[model samples]
Target: MADDPFALFDAWFAEAKAAEPNDAEAMALATASADGFPSVRMVLLKGHGPDGFDFYTNAQSSKGRDLAENAHAALLFHWKSLRRQVRVEGFVILLPDEVADAYFATRGRDSQIGAWASDQSRPLDDRDLFERRFEEMKRRFEGQEVPRPPYWRGYRVVPAGIEFWTDRAHRLHERRLFTQTDSGWTEGLLYP
Candidate 1:
């Protein structure tokens, strides 16, 4: 077993990316407020490196604010078609402004504007209001460079714990857990 969770994650993720029919890069991001109330939603996995896993969102969004307050988060990747799932827990850090700027610039112009149009996690009057706002943003940014909003950027979750699970016959499963320690990583098998 590999002591590095990231290596194991990469292996499993590669398999899913090749075999999963859709949204292979999607993950369920979980966050909690300072008080410990939890919330979760699906987000696209944007980047990965030795530093950690990255995703982008508005800083004022619920998940973003939760991370700001607590700086801790969890992630789950489930590939229903493959009967596999991975769970991760970690500390989150805001990405540098330059990194966010580059990523935002790469986004479609309409999407860049839409980031400024919708107030994520806020109650909306109706779909029409959202459509109207989207239209307004489209008009405003038409034939122009759409800059990344100050409130929009990316966050990286530096994982401390990760568990990979795979299904088998009779409900038996394969489970491997990797946890970071002061020295390095500790790997173990879990009964499933």
Candidate 2:
């Protein structure tokens, strides 16, 4: 494996993309509140590079609120078909408006409208009310592009550490941990 964590991630991700049955970019995002409560949820990995891994969400959502209070987070990617997993820990940075707008533009019209209508992580009295709100948004955006809502945006996780794990027979797994330093990343093996 290369000494560069990003390079190793790219190689593993490419293999995952080829072998995983579906949603190879799906990852478990873990966040916590400033007070110490934790939350985990599945999110799609929208983009990744040396800068970090990116994902989008409603700013007022539960996970979003957690991120706002505590910028540190972790992500886990598991490829069942390949029996491999990658763990990433990082600090979150909100994406620029233009970047968010560009990604939003690629979404389907209905999804765009949903983004406008859904008050994610909020209480809803009834499904009918939600549906009506969605319908209203659809009607309002008729014959016009649905702009990205102010609260809808993307965030990048600038990794401080990364760990790669591979399954092995007799429960003897392989683990490689990479920690970022001022100069670059330093790698080491972990007992598994």
Candidate 3:
């Protein structure tokens, strides 16, 4: 494996994209509130590079509120087809408004409208109410370019440590961990 965790991630991600049947970029994101209450949910990886891993969400949602109180998070990516998994721990930072806007512009028209219509993590009286709100949003933006909602934005998780694991026969597994240090990343093996 490469000394650079980002390079290793890229290589594994490419393999996953080829082998996984669907949503290769899907990951489990774990966050906590100021009081230490934790939450975990699956989210799609929207962007990634040396800088960090990015995912978007509604700022007013449960995860968002958790992140607002606590900037740290952990991510887990499991590729069942490849029998591999990657775990990342990091601090989260909001992406630049322009970056979020650019990505939002690329979403489908219906998705863009849904972003404006849905009050994520909030209680809804009924499915019909949501559908009605969606219709209203669609009509409001008809014949006009849908803009990114202020509450809808991306967050980048700056990793401090990353671990890669591959399953082997008879319950054996291979594990490699890389931790960021002041000088650079330090790699080590982990018992599996």
Q: Best-fitting candidate, measured by lDDT? A: 3
Q: Model 1, residue 136: displacement in angstroms? A: 1.7
* Pairs clashing within candidate 1: none
Assess candidate 3 and give its lDDT. 0.96
TM-score of 2: 0.97
lDDT of 2 by residue, 37-83 (tens): 99999999999999999999999999999999999999999999999
- The top-ranked prediction according to TM-score is 3
Off by over 4 Å in 1: 1-3
State each model's C-alpha RMSD to the native: 1.4, 1.0, 0.9
lDDT of all predictions, in order shown? 0.90, 0.96, 0.96
User: TM-score of each candidate?
Assistant: 0.94, 0.97, 0.98
Higher TM-score: candidate 1 or 2?
2
User: Who is ahead in lDDT, 2 or 3?
Assistant: 3
* Residue 158 shift from truth in candidate 1, angstroms: 0.6
How would you encode candidate 3's per-residue C-alpha lDDT over 22-136 as one tens digit per residue? 9999999999999999999999999999899999999999999999999999999999999999999999999999999999999999999999999999999999999999999
